[model samples]
Target: MKKVKHGGNIYEIAEKLGIQKEEIIDFSANINPLGVPINFKKALIENIDRIENYPDPEYNGLIQAIAKEHHINREYITVGNGATEVIFSMIASLKPKKSMILAPTFGEYERALMRAGSQVEYFHLKEENDFQVDDDILKTIDESFDLVILCNPNNPTSQMVENKRLIKILKHCEKNHVHLMMDEAFIDFVDEPTKETMLPYIMNYHNLIIVKALTKFYALPGLRIGYGITSNVRLLERVNDHKEPWTINSYAAMAGMVFKDKIYREKSREWITSERKDFFDELKKINKIKVYKPNGNYILFKLLEERKDLREVLLKKKILIRSCSNYKNLDESFYRIAIKDKGLNKLFAKALKEVLYES
Candidate 1:
């Protein structure tokens, strides 16, 4: 399998351009424009001495916080360096013989499946359907597959699997004895996450597993804090036992504090709700591209014009957007951009308009 290219690599772009990293306005990685929360910053500063010792292997406080936030049992929660670790470890433990994933979704699922020696298949999301998961997925998933993966409000595309339709798929997978892994990393940014989340279904279906990250929503990507939730205690134990010790550092363990920052949480909600609307609305005016309505903090668009070198052109202007060419089902014409604060988003819009039309 080939290596998957992820966004947020300002270092490489900076090096190639011989410019400082700070000069680049990145819309490549879908992170919070509000940046790190003030409370978390204070916690990090106060807990700087935490590095002096190893993190509690059990991560009691962290697990408790997460459990409280979701009202799930701590026994069902498993923490990792990031959702990536929990994903790899969970797949490894499951050791599924055959697995299925959505094409043009996050790349790590295939990579992790390959590492576990599972044969991978893709359920291609039709471009004409706005790349949304529909009833067809229920037919695609059956007893033949050992595991099925879904990225709710899927990456790049930023489209969600409707709750009603998702339940139908879940029932089908359950009846077929197929394990379903749902990565809800960006769900927090969506409107009405409570209505859409599958966290409530985990208890009823042992086969259901949810992988989430505090990285994007909490602006703690560098801290590498993520976790998996499932009612399958046995599977959780296996995942914990098979994994390396203390993959989560002391500082990362402090992620539990983020959940308690209600003030910061509300502020973040206000920012994403407002900015996502304004930014997406502005992008819609640019006729050079077809913008997909977004539920996450990022938007995916396709260049209607013939230009395939948009990323390069924008980079010259100190702007960076994710080229979707490397994603399984997407081509060079497709690109994904993070919804940022008003000024930067406007700047990106201007740069993109110039690249698409003026140039």
Candidate 2:
């Protein structure tokens, strides 16, 4: 199968441009701008020797931390290298005969479903409706599909499924005996995540599964820590027994401490809440693009004019924004950008105006 392109490929960009990767202002990846917590870095450094030993296969401590954070049973939790691993493993274990996903959603779901030999279908999000999930999704997901994947506060579009609608879909999936795999990788970046999450329903609905990652919120992508939650203990056991040992390394196991860092968590909330609003408002002032109000840490916009090469133009200025043309339902005129710090956000807005109007 052909590999799907994802953002955060600074190495490739640096090689092509003959400049250091650090020199480029990357808005391509929707990561927390505050970066890795200082306390976590200090702990990692102090315990660097932990890498000499292999990580516990059970990952008891990591699982405990995650379980505590969500107030769920530890038996329901399964850890993986990243959310991507959890996604693939869950699909493999479920081995759905048929699956459905959002047309312009995360590409990995389709790849995983294909790997499991399941026929794939898409629920296209209409751009005219601001790419929100509509009632048509309810009709599309019936007993015919064995598995349905949802990315909350979905990528590229940064639009979330309304809580009421999401609950309705969950009940519908349950009745139809279809497994609902909700990827909450970016949920922590959204406002009122507690209300938006479906964790509370896990115990009541055996058909629901949640995949989450500390990679984006904690800025620890290199550490590769992620997990899945479901009330189906049998399925969790199957995921655990499916294969490799020590997929999560020793250092990654220590990432459990990040969950307890209340100060860092609060500061991140403050930063994202402030930056997303101000930055989006500034971008809206630009007449050349139609900015979609974001519910996540990033924003998606469409070029109003005929600038098909906007990404290329911005790259010349050492700026990197995600080109959404490669997404199944989106076209070349669309792009997604991370909401960064105050200074960087202003720089991007200024550079964008120069690209759209000045040149």
Candidate 3:
């Protein structure tokens, strides 16, 4: 019911700080620190004149690239302005009377459900369990609920649900005639995406809808391109019918080309593999906080002994971290920090120590 403020807000921070947006070291966003792919940069620059033409409403080229990259049928995919757009559109199309979402998950799910006039319920992920989704969720989802949504490597908490457990839940939902939607937006940042992704099983489960984003893994949030995959052709058709024409722009459509940028993809893989380990270890050494073992490119930490305003202190140092207070099951003491380039990550830890220990 309350307004939600999701992160990646450098502009707002910069305005309040009376400085340029670039002055802020934004750890609030979980985007790849390797930045945009070189291929995308070159393509975008070369195709600057693309703005003169309208994007193909069907997004043929983009869809083809995505299908090829994932080795799935193009018809199984529905591209959107961002993963958020796809989420909102999918919920709108499903038009469920009651929907269940993980508490402290992405705020947009609740917002979208509310907008669609659906009664939304929360599956409160317990902090004691490191905020992971467990068997208790099975009890909460029942025939009355028409839809269930989950976020793998969930935001803010940085917790990934086990694949086997998730599959069990999906089967239960299918038997009960419930739609199951899984947001894998941050899954690519995880150490082993192939082992963790549910995308492979989509064809076998028509009720399963998997939402993915190029924003975090490819570092192209500004371009606003993401997509949803489902095997239910009828549902896909319904979603496409309800969407606004040309919601995806020319550059964004062409941006799909970057999905096949093997060099950029491998570089990101290596960066996250090394940095996530080093950064989590460093944060663990700082006893002022309780750091959750990171499986993704971000870490979730809780203040142990400090009552100081963590966000405010970090803001003063031109560093922005995600305050998890807005999430359903989290509180003021909890925060999420992006695993950035080694230099910036070290600087963040140093600044955090000064705030927690020295001053």
Candidate 3's clash total is 0
TM-score of each: 0.99, 0.99, 0.98
Off by over 4 Å in 1: none
Query: Would you list the clashing residue pairs of candidate 2?
Result: none
Candidate 2, residues 42-138, lDDT tens digits: the string is 9999998998888888999999999899999999999999999999999999999999999799889999999999999999999899999999999
- The positional error of residue 145 in candidate 1, measured at the CA in angstroms, is 0.5
lDDT of 3 by residue, 173-219 (tens): 99899999999999988878999998888899999999999988888
Model 3 is weakest, by summed lDDT over 10 consecutive residues, at 1-10
By lDDT, the best candidate is: 2
Clashing pairs in 3: none
What's the true lDDT of residue 108 in model 2? Answer: 92
The TM-score obtained by model 3 is 0.98
Q: Give the alpha-carbon lDDT of every model.
A: 0.92, 0.93, 0.91
Of 1 and 2, the candidate ranking higher by lDDT: 2
| Candidate order, lDDT descending | 2, 1, 3
Backbone clash tally for model 1? 0
